[model samples]
Target: MFSSKTLAEMDRNIAKYPPEQKQSAVMACLIAAQEEHGWVSPAIIAEVAGILDMPTIAVEEVATFYNMYETKPIGQFKLVICTNLPCQLSHGEEAADYLKKKLGINFNETTSCGTFTLKEGECMGVCGDSPVLLVNNHRMCSFMSHDKIDALLDELKSQAKKGVSA
Candidate 1:
């Protein structure tokens, strides 16, 4: 189910641990699969389990337990807004509402254009950076005011038009 390059990457990850501890590489292997496929599907989970010599349920638990791993396909850009109490106190809810209204999609839904997917995330370990969001689980945007949010949407839309990846 994975490409040669992806399997090679998984193999490299597996090599990081001792022979008897191949299961320790399960997370890394899943990440490689997700990177290649854009989401962790059932097939991917089984494949990773087979490769790491672990139970499928074990791999599934890891995938579902983490917010970073997407079990279903998502848009090109995944916007995860931290809606925990600290973030809510810092306008996180307002920001999330703004995004939902602007994109015409609620949390867990993707835009009609398939350009963005909105999700409410847990604390990202930066309570002080409340009202923060992540782009594709990588880029972090802090202190998201309305203006900043608008700017970000505009920028992402422009990038989408240009066939750019977020």
Candidate 2:
């Protein structure tokens, strides 16, 4: 279900490990699969397991255990907010509230337009950068204030209009 380029990348991940320990590349393979499919499904999980010679359940377990992996379909943008203690103490709650109100979607929900998916994330190891969030699990957005949030939303919307990513 992935392009040749993606398949080659997965092979590279497998090569990083010993031949007998090909399963070691499961996590990286799952990430690549998710990047291609946008979410992990039963079929994709099975494919990854087959490639790595692992049990399907084992691959599914890794995907489910990590918040970064989306098991269900998500919008064009996945907004993950860090609500850990330090972040909560530093305006994270306020930022989350604003995002919910603005997107009209609660945690673990996606907007009607399928433009954004809101998720609550664990600590991202940047306490000093409280009110932090991640876009698509790759872009770390720190110091998220109301105005910054608004700007981000606007920027994302504009990108969506152009069929691009921010």
Report the Cα lDDT for residue 3, model 1. Answer: 93
Q: Which portions of model 1 show Cα errors greater than 4 Å?
A: none
Local distance difference test, each candidate: 0.92, 0.93
Give lDDT for model 1. Answer: 0.92
Estimate, for each residue in 10-122, the C-alpha lDDT of model 1 and write its tens digit. 89988998999999998889889988888999999998999988999999999999888999999988999999999999899999999999999999999988999999998
Of the candidates shown, which would achieve the greatest TM-score relative to the real structure? 2
Clashing pairs in 1: none
Of candidate 2, the 10-residue stretch with the lowest lDDT total is 157-166
The top-ranked prediction according to lDDT is 2
Candidate 2 has a TM-score of 0.97
How would you encode candidate 2's per-residue C-alpha lDDT over 31-91 as one tens digit per residue? 9998888888889999999999999999999999987788999999999999999999999
